[model samples]
Target: MPVTDCYTCDREAEFDQLPPRERIGHDSLWRVSHATGSELLGWLVLVPRRHVMEVADLTDEEAAALGRWQVRLARVFAQELGTPKTYIIELGEAPGFHLHFHVVPRPVDLDPELRGPKIFGYLGRPEPAESPARDALATRLGAALDRLNE
Candidate 1:
């Protein structure tokens, strides 16, 4: 697919201008957090700061750092959220030219049918939730990131 304007850049811009949320944390090139309470499943999004579309666009330093950050965040989520495994996904199909990774936590007892590549099969579309819920989740995630710093 053709690359589009970077959504990560837009989000970073908005996040930087707005007051800091209690749920997010600074992890070098990206922000880390569990998904809002809407899905209590411990979903996380690792967004890059720059407006790059592919991994190839990342500098050697960024490439090396990305792996370390992913592993570290996954470890924290597993310990704090009781997740058995984490799924790191990079689907550049979206309009955002920036590269972001999805660090989805999975429980060991989770249904096999909904496991792996088919986790979101039933939830065909993103549900519309209240803004407060999102804000709350962001706050919680930000706090979690803070803990990781210590």
Candidate 2:
């Protein structure tokens, strides 16, 4: 995907302009932000600042930092949200999405029916009464990630 046409790239432009609920954490290579249309709280996304359709296209610095970002973000989610595990998925198939990783918190006892890829059903779905508010979740996670990065 071309940088100009990438949705992630457009969001990156909002680094300073977007509200906290939209922009989360980021470094030199990757920008971590809240996922749109997701009903799940702490649904963080890690996207490269530049457009790159494949993980193989990541530069050495970007690839190396990507690992650290994943580990750190996963750890923060586990620490702050008390998630037993985190699911990290990278699929660049969607139009304008480019290559991005979805870092999702998985409760220890996630329903069997919703395990694995099925968990994605929660994304873009209507809000559940049990779902936490996204703005509050983003604030907590963003602060936790900032402290972790320190």
Candidate 3:
């Protein structure tokens, strides 16, 4: 059951028309999108194709695919951008924001002050990376994901 007001559901419904950044990569059970309104370049969001509000709601296959995606995205970021670590978080607190996992790259030079949960300060901040830049990075990352899928 899809929620009419859900952000992820809204995007999922427009799968065919979504921009490259919004459909970076996907399998039958999940989709990856570049995080919008954020300065973080490689920040990606892994979302279920169907509407599910909690981890318990996920099917066994969905849960398995979710872990694989997180690992693959972390590996890609490490190989391509040399991010020492990646942060995976899920906080479905907002109204329209449904259950989605945030895979954020934590570079070696990242300010120690913004480590861990505090790194969220990078999101929703002023001066987010522009659309073209996001699209380019998404395209690059998407291609990397494609190669890995091979």
Q: Against the true structure, whose lDDT is highest? A: 3
In model 2, which runs have C-alpha deviations exceeding 4 angstroms?
128-132
* CA RMSD, predictions in order: 4.2, 2.6, 1.4
Q: What lDDT would each prediction earn against the true structure?
A: 0.64, 0.79, 0.88
lDDT of 2 by residue, 20-113 (tens): 6666777778888778767776777888888778888899999999999999988987888788889999767876457889998987777888
RMSD of 3: 1.4
Residue 95 lDDT in model 2? 63
Q: lDDT score, residue 116, model 3? A: 100
Order the numbered candidates by lDDT, best leading: 3, 2, 1
Considering lDDT, which of the candidate structures 1 and 3 is the better prediction for this target? 3
- Residue pairs with clashing backbones, model 1: 23-139, 23-141, 23-142, 23-143, 24-142
Error of 3 at 27 (Å): 0.7
Error of 3 at 18 (Å): 0.9
Clashes of each: 5, 0, 0
Residue 38 in model 1: shift from native, Å?
8.4
